[model samples]
Target: MIEYSTLKQTGRFIIILGIQILILNQIHLGGYITPFFYPLFILLLPFQTKGYVVLLLAFFTGLAVDMFSNSLGMHAAATLFMAFFRPGIIRLLSIKTEFEPEVEPRIHVMGKVWILTYTVMLIFIHHLSLFLIEVFRFYELGEILAKTIISAGFSVIIIMLTHFLMGSARKT
Candidate 1:
């Protein structure tokens, strides 16, 4: 059985994924800038989480979105792609201080710069994979780049706002 706290976390993940698919996915600004918050679930997961666990969560989360959005592997691929790199990015930007493995990457815990840098990097990787797979052609590189940038900006904002609003910003 999943631990109580882990269950609660799972519930929150489901809620955020729902919001992304049922609401945000429908709002494409100028037909391109669609907000994606589901990836934040993966981003917000505890830093100590095992790599395979993270990959599994990311795959299912993106798969859930893919099923809803009818985009078939785009969300899953991008999310899984980010999952593969999340550990590296965290290590690269993590301050030279030791931390418990279970500490979450919340804004207050890591500070705004760390949070922002981490989110931006992963979101960009996710979005780039998403948009590139979407176009599926090298010729439309400009369009893919634009879509990735605009969508990533929107995603980062939502992730940060939601992270703070959750009242979990305990700066340690």
Candidate 2:
């Protein structure tokens, strides 16, 4: 039988996936920004989660989004890359003494600075990989770079806002 925790996580994933596809996918700032909040799901997974599980979840999440967005495999590649690098990023920015066991990442749990740094760095990496893959060539390097940075910035803001709102709800 599936564990209660696993079932809850699955339900939450489905809800987030629907919101991402039905809501966020419709939002675009003239090709300059596309808020990709789905990555935050993978990002905020418990730190103690196994690397393989993270990678698999990231791959499937990207693939699902790609299916909905009709962007082929671009999302999958970028997301998997982000998942692969997340552990190292956390290790780099996290304080060893403050690390907790099996804790999910959150602004409240990790503090504002750590959360901000973690989100920015991961968003940058994810956006860069995604833009590069979407371009598939270096002909419009400047345009791609601009789009990546702008989109990443927008995505970071949205993700943080969502995190804060969710955190507040959790406390109530």
Candidate 3:
């Protein structure tokens, strides 16, 4: 029997997945701007989550998206990389002694600057890895770089907007 918290998490995951597939996936602007809503799952995870669990979830999350989009394994590789690096990124952004034990990654708790830096770094890493993997051959390095940067920019904007909206609700 699953606990209530576990059930709630499962529901949240499903809802986010649906939003990613049914909504965000259709908002692509040519090949340059793809809003990556899946990263929110990674960003919203509990601060104290285990590394392995994070990695597995990231891999599966990306794989699921890939499966739906027919993008092969690129998303899986990129997301797994982000998940693997997430803890380290948190540590790098964190003040260590000042970080709350059970806090989630939010603008309210970590401050806007920290959250912005964290999102930008992770989004860049994820987009770089994803486009590199998709392009495989470096013959189109310029194109891939352009796509990655543009897509990352759009994703970061969406992420910050989502954070601000959600944070405001939490404050009220």
User: Best-fitting candidate, measured by lDDT?
Assistant: 2
- lDDT, candidates in the order shown: 0.85, 0.86, 0.84
For 1-172, candidate 1 gives per-residue lDDT tens digits of 3487689787988899789878998898886588888888999888888889999999999889989888888888899999999988988896554567667888667788888899999999999998888779664788788888988999899888887886464443
Residue lDDT tens for model 3, 1-172: 2376468667767877898899988886985477887888888887976678788889888989999989978899999888888888887777673444456788888899999999999998999899898878764888888888899998999889989998999988
Question: What TM-score goes with each of the models?
Answer: 0.91, 0.92, 0.90
* Candidate 3 positional error at 85, Å: 1.3
Pick the TM-score winner: 2
Clashing pairs in 1: 48-101
Candidate 2 global TM-score: 0.92
Q: Lowest summed lDDT over 10 consecutive residues: which window, candidate 3?
A: 94-103
How far does residue 35 in candidate 3 sit from its true spot (Å)?
A: 1.5
After superposition, candidate 1 runs with Cα above 4 Å error: 168-172
Task: Give candidate 2's whole-model lDDT.
Answer: 0.86
Mark the 10 consecutive residues where model 2 has the least summed lDDT.
Answer: 94-103
